[model samples]
Target: MPHTISGFSKLSKSEKIEWLLNTYFTDKDSARALVKQYWNTDDKLQKLHDEFIENTITNYYLPLGVAPNFLINKTIYTIPMAIEESSVVAAASKAAKFWLDRGGFKAEVLSTEKIGQVHFIYKGGFDKLEAFFKNVKPKLISDTASITKNMERRGGGILDIQLRNKSEDLPNYYQLHATFETLDAMGANFINTCLEQFATTFKNEALLFKDFTGDESNISIVMSILSNYVPQCLVRAEVSCKIEDLKSKDIPNPEEFAEKFKQAVSIAEVEPYRAVTHNKGIMNGIDAVVLATGNDFRAVEAGVHAYAAKDGTYSSLTHCSITDGIFKFWIVIPLALGTVGGLTSLHPLVKFSMEMLQKPTAKDLMKIVSVAGLAQNFGAVKSLTTTGIQEGHMKMHLMNILNQFEAADTEKVTLIEHFKTNIVTHSSVVEAITKIRESGNFK
Candidate 1:
């Protein structure tokens, strides 16, 4: 069911927040039931909620406004995201909706597992360690599988393993990477746990081998580091629209928009500053999905920026172009997010938001996430080239800024709404605030 509608000017601040609050947690019994189903104790629930309140970077409760029309892989998803920018949400939603009037956005995802790195510090030769690990690859794979047994039973676990030796001048000189399929789970903690298991398994097993290092105490470094370059779960979204549906004001030939977009990317490839802004727009959509679903936005940002420079120049993560009437968009990001672990499960609304998305594998979820980014990119360029981003963005922003001064109180908001139609000018707003000040209404 759609949430009950409210005029933006009329909603109380507390009431607005109520929309984002997990409905399951609003009642003590429902929260308790949910907590018990996943958590071991009531204490854990308290800690989760406390972390959600104090630690999670809440984005001021902006609705992860829906795009209204996105049909991907026979599944219809109205993508949800929480972002403060106005045109990003507004343009994407409207543009998507317009396309939906024709056939709808067709989207797909590649896969959903993440890869983490295991670094080992040793004084020995990396070549020797590399050969040793190569011989033990089967054992290492089996050993890692044993750790994620529960996950495998549920159709997820260690999917594959690859080994590499870095000869850097470091104490613990060996590095091993294990790729695991976590299904709907994020797999960070699980992958890290497996790394620990491997560390101990190798050390104990090493003692049994003749060629093993004699220095026991020297095996002092073993840590699992999360890698952002997790092979991407790809997402693709395309909208086929009739020329009549597009406004020439937005683009003379909507079909040409795609060609222009393709050419625009060449500029991004050549210019570092434009590349930064372009990638930032992509992140704007991606980070919101990560946040709304309770994934690590910071790490996602780090990985994306790092990936942008992979070609030696900071460039856009996605590419866009229009051949004819068809517009094509694609984004490849190392989006290794889990739906059922850590903050994603701990946050009150995270689970609910996932449910709203109708549940998807982490990799498939990344596909959805990437499409939203493409939509955001298109929407961004559309506004910049058309209405100018500020006109629409500041209109919404001013409302928020204005509320900060006078809409803090319900009566004041009621006054603002009651008179919104009449108070169109800055001077009118000033006059009303002045009148309220003279009347001591703010008090």
Candidate 2:
């Protein structure tokens, strides 16, 4: 049968699903039922979700969990996390509690400057182009007045604009690099709007300049878009305590544990293979909170990873040090987040998540998110340097294994007890289940 169909997007939701089932499924009824099972019960809510994207099927869900006892900047918070990977929330919570009595976490917003660019190719002398940019800079700002009017009233608008020459990197290529203080919103649309206006005004003004020839005047606009590499939009989060105070059940010898932890971080700092995984652990915490709060996790991830590689070599976003008898672990990361636009007011659960954190501003949210990454890194490093990373992780993963095998309730209980004293692995769990069934001890 031919699978291609025109106007598929024009079909109604039911029709779309019917087409999909007929085209793709061997068991059409079971596939249809499974798709419907994930739909929202409320029609209005379902419609809203469907409109969020094109060809929307049922909503995909991630478990929303809360990790409590996050004492950041001397304020207590129970941070909400939306993630599917096992043990992330649990790890963050354990780290939070470990530092709760050690003066908790400290976070501060270092800066909040985002960036955008207007790219064009002009086959002309650099001197003439430089003079043209200097003359037309005011016009570029003035042309975007309408778009920046409301943002300026809110105390945030275009910060500055610069003309960058890139002839060496790419012949006849240059850029109008602009900076912005977006305040509480991620401001992608705002920045792109201003860049487009700047592009229009720059090209228009060039045509009128006597310093430009017709070819130069006809500057070809390559593109105008916001860059996701926000090095200036930075936040720092750290936790520090006396080395002697780092005592816990997991760290009987605080000195030995602290040294090993510092060495672990050091290895990641210079080794890209280890650094990638190390930063991923940090983002597991960062992305969860970013998602729960309805911010753009993809943008955040891109900016952060770029910043990690900014020093020319990909390195860890987190660091640890021991100085003056104190052990300090910290992370400096780039996060461009918003709390007043996009999904903040639209999604009910996002609103709930905002209120759960006492309604933080963008800066406040940045601080909170940085602390989460720091705490998560600390927990992971602590585990790795001490008892190893697999012990607790596999235990948390046992339930997933049990579910994959479709174990009954009583069988799960028995297996849960059995694994408490034994190591949990896929093969081990499968062997235990097989033996239990063969012994006729389970129904």
Candidate 3:
């Protein structure tokens, strides 16, 4: 069935969402049925809902439009993100156009695997602990079956056991990062529960185990820590276009943009303070999609930030290079997400975002998330490189300002996009937009 309303702009926001719904589900019945299966909290779900609700200062998630012209792994995609930051969407859209002409970005992802650590801090020889894990992993893994019998029955349980000796830089911190194939589900509860039980074995082996993990290592053992971050997975995006395409368009200095982009990334890599915010700008495009999908945005944020500071110093997650006058961009992130779990089964908008993501596998989802971060980073770095941030950001920011002033949608967007392109002076753009607002149309 077609949308109950035709033209998208004429529909209410909820109606527009309903129209979007038509694109994904076979019918309204299917979509509505999912809501009942997922979000319906008659009694059992209500108790679960009550378990975690708090008053918070969260913003209304606005759709960040990352334009068409993106080709990933020979697949054309116009990825849409939900973000409010200025220039991020436009810049990514712009980069996509540049890449599209060059046969799009070539991408490859390894797997859709995520590691959940059940950290057991011990006051013993790190070597002894490492040897214990290496010697008894098979027994340990077999023992996992009884613990996750229910999960095993549900087709998800201990898939791999990985032991890593934490660097002496962090004392008594030997992390047991358990790899789980959470198949169509988020594995927080399953992974953490299995690890907590495994801790008892170490306690029985070495009496010091419980005490060391107890406090001296400052471990109270927080559970249900869901990880959207995985190990450093590889991702690549590249664009090759004729130099004339840029010069022919007469869109300011192209060479300058390349040089500045490199320098900005270098700066972001060197300074932790700068890297935090720079990476946050990258996440503005990423978290929006994560939010729109009802995935845990907070976990993604913490993981990305932690990954940024991984080297004892902070650095950019993306790296750039200029080869044969073709600018190439690459980024690696531990984006462990799934399309079959949590809100992917519940929310209507999550279904919409998932469609926009083009049916990403658990691995594919991480690849796309990395692309979003890199694409957004390229846009920001490009803007800062060729034109100061203001040239690219001011226009979208005006829309933010207009919305703050309660301007209507029609006048708000039109004036903002128009003034961005033709502004001679700030005073003129502001006055012209204000006058247009008074006249009820931008023209």
Candidate 4:
């Protein structure tokens, strides 16, 4: 059994690793060696990685790849994606190349509004709380002037503040709902600061309100924070071409492919089970780019999932249609991304990713990220409607499976050629490799 030690954080890096190994592993030498194997060789870089989070032991790596030929808003871009999944980058690239000749993708920002709230309880009459809120609203705004001054100068600051009463739903629950334009920053910290200030002023003023009687006078603030549900902060991306132009090598018949693709999206829109997996495919691309850029994928995932279920039922984020001679596929998702703040300037790879993107603004990043989701969905739907998803996905996954079997470079080359015609399954690959070894074919 492991015992908890006080002041564990005060230990030196080596000391901490020693304690962890002693506590957990029987073979401490080998375990310690395994941990240090991932550390950066450069002393300065390793230190930088260690300081990125608390109680850091060593680095965890994911492949950073680029998907080229993404034409958005008539501008060509090569998107950088950091992910461990086998087929995500390949799928996204295929989709981008497919649409590249078909007029590529078009994207536009619908809105840039974000939200925050302050929750408090007041066991008083609703009318009395409403009356007090109206009188205190201006003061709440004024008290946050210091916090909003810099943001205002940047042309992005508090947009509006409104009081909401939810006494019927939860006894004496009230919220100070606020909206903001964060410009080039994700603005969580900014919105949270303003909310905390608003909560302070609200509680301070409620104590002095003349209308308050009994429990109404004692307003207890529960918490103040920025919401991850920014429905209004939306971006739309789409690809459209003549129905005849949708024909490809795999999709020999444009009309059949288009019809099948439309039906697939429609099913996802109404079926919760399909919709959940469908949206996850879209996020495989979105989250990869979001992570590469050093933005918060968790917040993006939360906001987008909420937006999908906004109609009281979970549904697909991407939609498709074939009208007249045109076939179109598109998605509109809420993405609050930043190009200037947080890790964008600090992390080396993040800075490189911004440069690779031509240093887009928040709105531009929104368009790019939305296009990524749309392109990813296109690839998935196209696969689902045609040769099915596994053929391509498993082909990309073949290398990973090969590596797991401990195949040598020579064996990998032989298997790659052999599997070109044969179906690539784990069992089949393993059996073939074992037979080849027993035959002494390569040796």
Alpha-carbon TM-score of each model against the true structure: 0.74, 0.98, 0.70, 0.97
Q: For candidate 3, write residues 12-49 as lDDT tens digits.
A: 53464465567667787866555445443466544444
lDDT of candidate 1 over 112-198, digit per residue (tens): 656777777766665666666666667766776667789989987776666665655554466667677777777777878887777
- Model 4: per-residue Cα lDDT over 139-159, one tens digit each: 998999999999999998989
Q: After superposition on all CA atoms, how large is the RMSD of candidate 3?
A: 11.2
Residue 26's C-alpha lDDT in candidate 2? 97
2 or 3: which has the higher lDDT?
2
The per-residue C-alpha lDDT of model 3 at residue 351 equals: 77
As a whole number from 0 to 100, the lDDT of residue 115 in candidate 3 is 71
Q: What order do candidates take by TM-score, descending? A: 2, 4, 1, 3
The per-residue C-alpha lDDT of model 4 at residue 251 equals 84
Model 1 spans with C-alpha error above 4 angstroms: 1-48, 51-67, 168-172, 212-222, 240-249, 252-259, 324-326, 343-346, 407-443
Greater TM-score among 2 and 3 belongs to 2
After the best TM-score superposition of candidate 3, give how far the Cα of residue 185 lies from its true spot, in angstroms: 4.2
Model 3: residues >4 Å from true position, as ranges? 1-61, 64-66, 110-113, 121-137, 146-175, 183-186, 204-229, 233-256, 407-443
Report lDDT per candidate.
Answer: 0.65, 0.94, 0.64, 0.92
Candidate 3 residue pairs in backbone clash: none
